[model samples]
Target: MIQKDSAMKLPVLFLGHGSPMNAVRDTPYSRNWRRLGQALRQRYGGEIRAVLAVSAHWCTDGTAVTAMPKPRTIHDFGGFPQELFDVRYPAPGSPELAAEIRSLLGGHAVAADFGWGLDHGTWGVLCHVFPEADIPVVQLSLNVNLDAPAHFALARRLAPLREQGVLIVGSGDIVHNLRLMDRRAPDEAGSAYEWAESARSLVNGWLENGDTQALTDEAAYPPALHLAAPTPEHWWPLLYAAGAAGADEPLQIFNDDIVGKSLSMTSVVFGHDALFEAV
Candidate 1:
């Protein structure tokens, strides 16, 4: 087996996949995800066993990890084109990894289920990263009700998985205030863009520091964060990824930008050496 630090570590990603359009358009964000996926594969093609995605959409009462051996594509959103609905990511599911995830969380905190499949949050980005849909995947549900601290702790617990070649992904938008999601309001776009950019810069700092405390505490963030995240579900994944960073680990921004008023689709990658060096 490869030594933990010596072998390239699998980096964690925080993808700000804005609109459902990402599932279809070959825009910069989609292209970036694709390029990142290809680069990751080229670096660790045969060694990567599975991908564990923590999507913003599958928020439940408690932490649940999908254990199914063959997970399917779930069209979780509506009002999309038939072509978008038809898009599929056929990444296999890993039972062994599921068991390991359960084991990683210990007995009480983590639960397992067999049927849940990939939601738009997972496939929206993965469709680009692993377009071939060849790698096995496991979807881990977010405890929507859980606070940032809880999510951060959970991420720390999951840190070891990177050594084993599991790419942990956090899927959500940064400035996701649906009330202002106007595709046409120019004023709304400018304000939301400003907020998203500010928030992204602050978040980038925290990630680079691997500051678990700052990530968990709401007050530590800018005032805009409250507006960006009226709920904790979307931002919690970032805490998880950051907590998984240990200390002083380098964080890289894979994609960053604000789209529309309520959608900040800027995404990030943590563990610079782990990912870039290998690439």
Candidate 2:
């Protein structure tokens, strides 16, 4: 069956989009993202139909997907440099893909949003991924009303799109606690707190073992989760990718690093070895 074949299917990705500045900065994170994007074509060997992005920035009342013809690049964050604010990703929106998503997720309360556009959680990484901005993208808002389990089930419904050339990307941090960052630490570059690493390791084990239940089970994780994810919005995207992953898909973590002492820049790809093998 086509569903069982990796050659014709698109892989899923979970990107830790640390900061909006990475969109314009030539940092290590951005460099890795660019390399991974190039690897997608060489390793996957299929034409990309479109990109279906589930970003942490777009937390909606209900599930929504951007249906505009030309979606605007929204600098959703504040306190960034002027250059970062000037940066814009001119990626076109895909109404056809949006309609397809609406049909795929039948009876799931999916909305076609003309107002919302690509936020930093998306374009920040996408600008590095596909710099040409030639590919059409549709942003799916993470329904704030739903929990991790619900999000997981929601993403699973779109699994069929993988075989149709839609790249499913979940953009958020695994460990994102801005307040927990230690500014006092010297050489603040890519420094991780003990709690952050512990939380990452705990969650990594779940991902490696394909333990979706333990990942969503609130009681199963350690207290480090509190520090790792003070709010679940950022961490929730991981569950989306996890749900979209095949039952026995090969999962690999790359660009694994902790930034700002709390935020984790660890990114993962399912059903591909290029990103890891290249490095």
TM-score of each: 0.90, 0.93
- The model with the greatest TM-score is 2
Candidate 1, residue 101: the lDDT equals 83
lDDT of 1 by residue, 54-80 (tens): 888888888888888788899988887
**Residue ranges of candidate 1 with Cα displaced over 4 Å:** 1-6, 185-193, 273-279
Worst 10 residues of 1 by lDDT: 185-194
- TM-score for candidate 2, please give it: 0.93
Q: In model 1, what lDDT does residue 172 have?
A: 83
- Per-residue lDDT over 1-279 for candidate 2, one digit per residue giving the tens place of the 0 to 100 score: 112334487789999988777788887788888988888867664468689999989998999999999999898878768998888899998889999999989999899999989999999999988998988899999899998788989989988888887899999999898887765752245657889889888888888888888888866667899789889889888888888887578877886878778888889898765554524
lDDT of each: 0.76, 0.84
For each candidate, C-alpha RMSD in Å? 3.2, 2.7
Model 1 clash pairs are none
